[model samples]
Target: MSHEHRHQSHPRIVARLKRAEGHLNAVVAMIEAGRPCLDVAQQLQAVESAIRSAKQTLIHDHVDHCLDARNSEAEREELKAITRYL
Candidate 1:
């Protein structure tokens, strides 16, 4: 596909990933500081959820833009690959 067909969610996904990175760093810091297990788990969960959301958004963009830019066979295979993520 051409560069013009690139997924539009790139920026949003990057932002979400950065937020998740921050949360993961905080989780590590909490563990190092001997913080409560529950608090650490909560932060870890937040990071996981953020990453998942970003992944879903990315997949949506791929379906909407990337796949549409490809041929039928490629699009079908890409759809299959996308379902594997679920």
Candidate 2:
């Protein structure tokens, strides 16, 4: 896929990341405020999930658009790189 096509979902990905950032900030505040451990953990879990979702979105987009244009060897290398996220 062309650069333009590959970046089609960039805005969405950025939005997710921004949300995760905000969630992380909240987690920090929760810690400082002496919130319950359970509550802090829950917020941390949410932040982790948000980041994971963003990662999956990025990998999926790469597979759908960028990978199609790559050769077999390059695709294998790319897949290897993507696996680190898993």
Candidate 3:
């Protein structure tokens, strides 16, 4: 694949990831501050949800922008490999 591959969804995906990062940092702080376990767990779930959403969007963007009917077998394999992460 080309190193210069770009997708229209990339910017939004990045923003989502950055927000996830911030949430993850907050989760760590919550743990240190002795926050209630339920509160911490809920925040952790939110962080996980953010990251999962970003990953799904990124993978879909890749499939939309990078794959086609004429794609090679290797490309199809790559797609399958990425989907396994989900």
Top candidate on lDDT is: 3
> Which one wins on TM-score?
3
lDDT against the true structure, per candidate, is 0.82, 0.82, 0.86
User: For model 3, how does the per-residue alpha-carbon lDDT over 1-86 read when each residue is reduced to its tens digit?
Assistant: 44576788889989999998999999899999999999999999999998889888988888776579898887888878887776
Clashing pairs in 2: none
lDDT tens digits by residue: candidate 1, 23-85: 999999999999999999999999999999998887877766645544678667867788678
Task: Tell me model 1's lDDT, rounded to 2 decimals.
Answer: 0.82
Q: Is candidate 2 or candidate 3 better by lDDT?
A: 3
**TM-score (C-alpha, index-matched) for candidate 2:** 0.78
How do the residues 1-86 of candidate 2 rate in per-residue lDDT, one tens digit apiece? Answer: 22234467788999999999999999999999999999999999999999999988888877665455445775667667877876
RMSD per model, one decimal: 2.7, 3.4, 1.7
CA shift of 7, model 1, Å: 1.4
- Indicate the TM-score of model 1: 0.83
Model 1 spans with C-alpha error above 4 angstroms = 1-5, 66-70
For candidate 3, the per-residue lDDT at 12 reads 94
Global CA lDDT computed for model 3: 0.86
Assess every candidate by TM-score.
0.83, 0.78, 0.85
Name every residue pair that clashes in candidate 1. Answer: none
